[model samples]
Target: MKIAFTAPMKPLDDPVPSGDRTMGRLIVQALELGGHEVRVASRFRTWVKEGGDAAILTRETEGLSEADRITREWEAEGYRPDVFLTYHLYHKAPDWIGPALADRFNLPYAIIEASRAPKRQTGPWALGFRAADDALARADVVGALHHADAECLGAVLQRDRLKILLPFLDTLPFETAADLVIKHHKAPKLLAAGMMREGDKTRSYEVLADALSRCMDLDWSLTVIGDGPNRAYVESLFPPERTSFLGALPPEQMPQHYAAHDLFVWPAIREAFGFVFLEAQASGLGVVAGSTFGVPDIVQDGKTGLLAPEGDAEAFAAHLRALIPDPARIEQLGEEAARHIRFRHTLEMGCARLNAFLETALDNRWQRSTAPRRPHQSSGQPL
Candidate 1:
């Protein structure tokens, strides 16, 4: 199957520390692995540490228009994809054009990782939400990353049509210095990676700090990875010497950072699906994330790792402290986490499922289109 993929708000090829970028790359790879041709339709841009290339996507209508030009160019080449795929369609870039294009080409329309909130009404964003609703209603399949997201569009989505496709990991390639898990230590190193925003995450971090303060009797260190606008402020609060800030590293080098630590902690405010937890679990580390959004679906509360009370830093710290003494549990849970993710959450599994589902959907469509037309009948008699 030829898939026409589009990510309107953020370009599919955008270089950023984002779940959307991760999912976009994963889906493309999955489709390719499933033996499907994927043509990503979005404004192309190459990100530089200095800045982005203006020639790629200018900050004006002209930039978006150029994207549309490329979409048309593909359509002109008699290459209408069998299915039109769009991910992360929100108020920014609603599927005004993508859906219409799908309809014109007689292809199945599909959406991945879309969300809406009723409280976000009373603004231009409302218009975008309504449009997203329409696009979702028309879609033949909607792959929701979170159960809450599936509930958000419950009015239109068929239960069977909505598949819970969790966030996937390609598994970063890295060389470990040593089996840190084997090393005997009095203190356990807790690792976390995410943006340092002041919302729920910052508050959670503060709570974790407070919890850790309460457990000063225990030996432990924290490593906060990734950097953002709030870096200076978060760093000011949790200095590097105590809570080392490693900023961001390339995806390939991320696993080594995780392997160097024993556990992963991320108590987000409200996450749709925390891909970082997936990455952590993939790195053979036990995860302790909050119990909100789609986290439970990712981290098995007890088997894979633990889930603290949402925003309860005390609970997080208690859980973290408990694992410090239990080297056997860490080894057991870490291996369990890796096996669970390797089997269920790999990009290969996701893509294989996606390919099978699309092929089934296409086959259903063909059968419906070519089925024999029955003679018109009224009540109990044929006309």
Candidate 2:
């Protein structure tokens, strides 16, 4: 099958390092692994951070123009795709070209990680919300990455059209690092990784600092990774002597860091199933994160890691205090964490799930096109 892929939130080859970009690359890899010819259809991003209806209109016009150009080129070359797959459709970054191209080519349309926010229907993002809603209605199949997204997507799509596509990655590097690295820390070494920015990220840092402050009596050292505009403020939240900042590092250098540490800690306020949690667990590190949104989907409480109530610094601190004294329990959790990721979350598993989704979409499209049509009573036309 030839699949035309698009990521409206971020381009697959974007130089900036982010979770969105990483997921986009992984989707392409998964499709290729399934023996499908995948091509990135467009790089025209439709994300609008802060804008009125005018901003949405401008993007809509540009998106239509881009779709026209691609249609012409593909027709000239006689290249027709069997399916149109899009990743990350939301009010902030609704897909504008995928639906148009899919209609023009008469192909099955599918979306991954499609979120619907009914509250945005009347706000400043009304146009974008409507556009996203229309796209969701037209999708033959929608893949939800976590349980929370699946619930919200169910409100607008049929139950059979919605599938749970668990978050996954290539865990070979982390698994190799876990097998090779031996931790020998004087005090239990803790690790946390996230971009330091305003909004929810800085709030997570604040909660982490407060939680760590309450556990000062315990002997532990924390290493923080990532850098952003709020680095200075985020650094100020933690004690200089107890925390070591590694700044921002490349993706290739992260597995060793995860393996060197004994635990991964983060407040995870409003996080959307963090990839860092998966990476940390893949490297045999037990996690302690706030139970919010999709955090529970990846990290099983009491099985792979401990989850505190969201934003409760006291509960988070108590969990840390309990684990710091018991190295045996920490090791046990880490072992379980590694095993969980190996069995349930991997590139191969993700590829199989994606292939199944494509097959379902194609079958749905074929049934709809071949179904019997009734004539309209008023105009004598096929309805």
Candidate 3:
């Protein structure tokens, strides 16, 4: 099967290292691993940083033009995609190309990680909201990475159309590193990795700094890996002596860092299924993360890692205090964490799941198209 894929939020090849970009790349990799030919249909991003009616209209117009160009190019090359798939669709980054291309090519349309925000329909992002909703309604299948998203998506889509595609990663490197690295740290080394930006990331950092501060008497050292515009603010939040900043490190170098740490601590405020949690657990590091959206789906509380209530520094601190004293418990959790990722969240598992999802989407499209249509009671139009 040939798949025409696009990530409207962030292009897969975007230089910025983020969880969104990582997930986009992994999805393409998963498709290719299933023996399907996947082509990135476009890199024309439709994301509006600060919402405005004009911005949304401009993106919509540009997106339509790009869609037309792609259709013509594909026709000339005799390449017709069997499926048009998109990842990460929301009001802020609604997909404009996928729906147009799918309709033009008469292909099965599917979306992964799509969020529906009804409240945005009357705001500055009204156009984007409507566009995203239309795309969702037209999709043959919608993959929900988080259960919370599934609830809202279910309102606009059939229950069967919404499939649970949990967050996953290529855990081989982290797992291998976990097996090879020997822990020799003097104090329990806690690691946190996230871009030091404002909003949720910075809030998480602030929560983390406060939580760690409470455990001052405990034997632990903190290392943070990431850099952003608000680095100074994030740095000031943590103690200079206890916390060491590694700045931003490439993805290739993360496995070793994960392996070096005993615990992965992050106040994942409103995090949508953190990839770092998966990587940390895969590297045999017990996680202490805030129990936010989709965090529980990956990090099994009291099993692979411990979760504190979202934004509660006291609860997060308590978890840290408990784990710091007991290296045995941390090691046990780490072992289970590694196994949890291997059994359920590896690339191979994701590939198989994605292949099934695509097949289901194609089947659903065929069924819907062939089903008999009912006449509308008011106007006698096909329903």
Candidate 4:
């Protein structure tokens, strides 16, 4: 199967990277791993943070031109993709290219991580929001990352088209790293990594600071990693002597960081599922994160990690206080966390699930004459 991949929020080669960009690149690789030939549909980002009437019209025209250009190029090559797969389709990042190009090529179109909200039909981003809703409605199938998203997508996509897929991470890096489960700890060393932005990021940081301060009676120190616009503000929330900031580390370096730390603690407010939780568990570290959207999917409550109520600093602090002095419990949870991620949340597992869903989505429409589409390159490798 030849898949035309596109992400409206950002390109696979985006410079200022985030979890979304990483997910986009990973999805393409996962499809390829499933023995599908994939190509980038367009690099032009159709994401509009917020725009009024005039700006909306301008972006609409630009999206059409970009889609037309890709259509012409693909037509000239006499190549028609079996399907078009768009990643991260939300109002803030709509599928401005994939839906249009898929319609032009008369191909099946699918989306991953698509969300819809009717209330946004009239806002500064009303145009983009409508476009996203239409794109999801047109999809032959949509892979939802969370139950919340699946419920939301129900308004736009049919039951047959909605596939619920949990947010996942590539666990190979952490799986191959040296284990830190046996590390000695007189005072547990906590670790957290997240960009320090104004909205959710800063709020999470502030919540974490409050939680940690309340746990001062416990024996623990901390290390924070990540850099962003509000570094100074975030750093000020913590005691300078107790916290060591490592700034931002590359994704490749995260496994080692996870392995070096005793506990992974962070308050993820309304997160789809923090990618770091999976990474930390894969490295055999117990986690303490706020109980929010999609988090319970990644962090098994009693088995792998502890989850405090969404915004309860006292509960979050108590969780830390309970775990800080208990090495036996930490090791027990860490072992379980690692095993959980290996069996359920790895990239290979996610790819296998997606491959099966895509085949189902193809339904009876699939035929061997689509054979020239190429041999099934993937042998259904184990994740």
Candidate 5:
């Protein structure tokens, strides 16, 4: 199947450290691997970052044409993808462009990792929400990674149309360092990765600090693997010497860090779907996450890793303390986590499910439109 994929926040090839970008690239790779054609719709910002690549799309051509241009370009080429898939769409590029493109091209629309917060509805933002509502209403499939998102939007959209497609990690690269990774293991080390945002205070740096204070009582070291605005604040909360804020490492360099750590700890509150959990799990790290969002869907309590109540520092610290001493259990959980991801949450699995959904949606649409039905007169009687 040919797919027109767009991501408003970041393009697949954009040189930005983000979960959305990571997932976008993985999706593209997975679809290609699954024997499908995928074309990424790059935005001006992405092209600008690439220097000469900016020439492919002119500023005026891009700015002047608007959403209709996408359909026109596709039609001009005499090619229309079976589906228009968008990722991390908010009011920005998603609401306006997606519906227009879908309506113009007459194709199934699918959105991945979408969100709707009612409080955010006001002024110009209100229009975005309305557009999101329309898109959701007309969408053939709305892939939700987190349960909260599904619950929030389920009231508006058909429940059957919403499928839980958890963001997965690509673990093929991590296979090379099997021996070296195991070698770095000593006392239990916990790892947390991804850029931090302070407004939500969701990364749970405060919880990490408390965990460390209690971790000294237990035999373990905590390693935070990403950087953001919350870095300095979080780092300051912990002993500067003990906690390592390695900023953001290259994607290739990440597996080594994961390998060095024995466990993964993410205390963020209300996550959409923590892809880091999948990554950590894929790297064979015992998982620890806050019990909110789709995290429960990923981190099976006592099976893959432990779950702490959202923002509960003492409880999080306690769980880590208990798990640190038992290497056998830790190894067991890590193995299970990896196995679970390989079986259920791999990019391959996600793409296959997506493909199946598209096929079903198209078939259903055809059936609905074509099936024989009784004609009703203006008086409401069947003719």
Candidate 6:
């Protein structure tokens, strides 16, 4: 299958330390592993950072034109794709290209993790949100990673058309260090890795710091691996002497950090299934995180990791403290966590699910071609 892939959030090669960019790259890698011909359709991003009527209108106009131009350029070269695949779609970074290009070229369209909301249709992001809705409305199959996203989008689109794909990555890199990582098992070490940015990330850091401070009886050392605009602020959240900031390390060098730790701790406040959580699990490290968003889908409470209620510092501290007294339980959870990821959330598993979804999409698209074209119908509308 010749798949034209694009991500409106960020280009796969973009030099930005974002989870969205990482997810985009993973999707491409998964597609290629599934034996599909992948094409970088367009690198033109449709990310709307700020919200305002005038800003959105201008963005919508320009973004739409840019998408069309890319399609026109392809037409000139007599090249057409079998399907248009977009990664990561939300109100902030709406997909303004895939749907328009697919419509132009008369091909199947699929969106991976495209979240939708009714209220967004009439706000400052009115145009971008609608464009995103249109794409979801037009999608032959919508791949959803989070259960919450699926539930919200199912209200607007066919629940049957929404296929669940567990977020995944190539864990082989980390798997290789399993033997060496086991040796770093000594000491009550905690690992926290993510972009130390404002909003949810900062909130998570603040809550975690507070939670750790509450664990006064527990003896632990924290190693933070990330750097962002709010690095200074995030660093200040933790105890300076005990918390060692490792700065940003490349993905290739991350397994050592994961292996060296006994527990992966993070207060996942409204996270859409953090990839780092999985990476840590893959390295056979137990987790201590907040139970919210898509986190439950990954971290099995009381099994692979002990989860505290989202934003509950005392509970989080208590949970960590509870685990610290019993090192055997933590070790068991880490072992189980690694096995869990290997069996369910590896690259091969992710590719198989995606290939199945795409096959279904292609089959449906072929079936639709036999009938007369109908006007685009969207089950979701602006409230």
The segments of candidate 2 whose C-alpha lies over 4 angstroms from its true place after superposition are 371-383
Worst 10 residues of 2 by lDDT: 374-383
Clashes of 2: 0
How far off is residue 242 in model 3, in Å? 1.3
Specify the poorest-scoring 10-residue window by lDDT in model 3. Answer: 374-383
lDDT of 4 by residue, 107-166 (tens): 667788887777878878788788888887677788987787788878766687888887
- lDDT by residue (tens digit), candidate 2, 120-146: 999799999999998998888999889
Task: Please give, for residues 1-383, the per-residue lDDT of candidate 3 as tens digits.
Answer: 77889999999989999999999999888888889888999998989898889999999999999999998998899787778899999998888799998887767799999988789988899999999998998899999998989988988999879999997899888978877889987789999999988899999999999999899998899999999999999999888898999999999999999998899999899888898999999899889999998899999999999999999999999999999999999999999999999899999999999989988887777677753742221221222
The per-residue C-alpha lDDT of model 2 at residue 301 equals 97
Cα lDDT tens digits, model 5, 1-383, are 67777776576667767667788788778878778788864452311222122232342245336566666776688766666777775444334455567666666677877777776466445544555676677677787777778787777777667777777767776545434664445677778775766754435777767776877766666687777767777677777656677887888888778878888887866566677787788877788778877788888898999998988888997888778888888999989988888888877787787677666555544443433642221122211
**Which candidate tops lDDT?**
3
Candidate 6 on 196-297: residue-level lDDT in tens? 777998898998999999876677889999988999999888888789999999878988878878889999898888888899899998899998878888
TM-score of 3: 0.96
lDDT of 6: 0.82
Clash counts for the predictions, in order: 0, 0, 0, 2, 0, 0
Q: How good is model 4 by TM-score?
A: 0.92
Tens digit per residue, CA lDDT, model 1, 1-383: 66778776677656776766777778888889878788876543312112223321232234346446756786578555677778776544466555666666655677777776776454535555566677777677777787877787675676656766677767634214224335454567888888777676677667666666666776678898877777787677654555888887877767778888878888866777788888888878888778888888888889889898888878887887788778788777778888888878887888877876675445434443543532221111111
Residue 28's lDDT in candidate 3: 88
Whichever of 2 and 6 has more TM-score, that candidate is 2
Name the lDDT value of residue 110 in candidate 6: 86
Q: What is the C-alpha RMSD of each candidate to the true structure, in Å?
A: 7.0, 4.7, 4.9, 4.2, 7.2, 4.7
